[model samples]
Target: MTKIGKALGVLAAAVVLPLTLSGTAYADIPFNQPINGNATYYDNSGFGACGTWVNAATEMLVAVPASYWTTPNPNNDPLCRGVSVQVSYNGRTITVPVKDKCPSCGSGHIDLSLPAFSQLADPRLGNIPLTWKFVRS
Candidate 1:
């Protein structure tokens, strides 16, 4: 091939290579896996809102959205009912209830109540790292 043709081929390959590589990298991520995890409540008063409790040892507070509370009646979904949460702080585990909605929670953040905070430990720690799962029972 001519030098010009080879340069064009190289440029095209550069563009196409990234597209192909990124496609495979995206597939490596398990999108099907549930986006479940521990989140901290951003309640200034330290008293978090109401939600569902899940898991056994981990204290994860799944904050319910405002839309769910606005309705005259809400369904008893486990996610909405507050599932048990497992909080891991300094390698210690504490369980707390999922209560209330977090006004500051950005999208996936879960808020917890003061009572729940106490159950896990102290809220002063700020942004407690927790791991949790959704349960049917």
Candidate 2:
């Protein structure tokens, strides 16, 4: 092959190689399990007391109370601030995080922030009846 052709081929490989490597690296990370149960909220106390959820696209988002949101060593791990939750309603399952505290929520029910709730249920439904299981990731 001509020198110019070989040089171009090398340049293309240089750009493509790293992208290929990164894609594999990303794929190695396991996706979180689907939570299917109920949900409830509690005060964040730097003890991994936050919540996490999985969207329809399987993306996980976590939510912690504002108080614990800035505390160091919360849940003893830098990444443990978010709570993992699975919500089950009428045989359908949805998981989501508590991005913020629910000022209006009573005991045994975590109040999901508007955006988070919307992701799991229709906003027009008002409050959804669901069961959630919490876990630390």
Candidate models: Cα lDDT each: 0.47, 0.46
**Any runs in candidate 2 off by more than 4 Å, and if so which?**
1-82
Error of 2 at 130 (Å): 1.3
Cα error, residue 117 of model 1, in Å, equals 2.2
Clashes of each: 22, 14
Each prediction's TM-score versus the true structure: 0.38, 0.38
For candidate 2, the per-residue lDDT at 64 reads: 31
| lDDT per residue as tens, model 1, 1-137 | 99999999999999998677555543443322343444554433333333223332244344534432432223322233434444444556555444455445553345665445555657777566554432322
Error of 2 at 74 (Å): 7.5
Instruction: Assess the local accuracy of residue 87 in candidate 1 as a C-alpha lDDT between 0 and 100.
Output: 47
Give the per-residue Cα lDDT of candidate 1 at 96: 46
Error of 1 at 132 (Å): 2.7
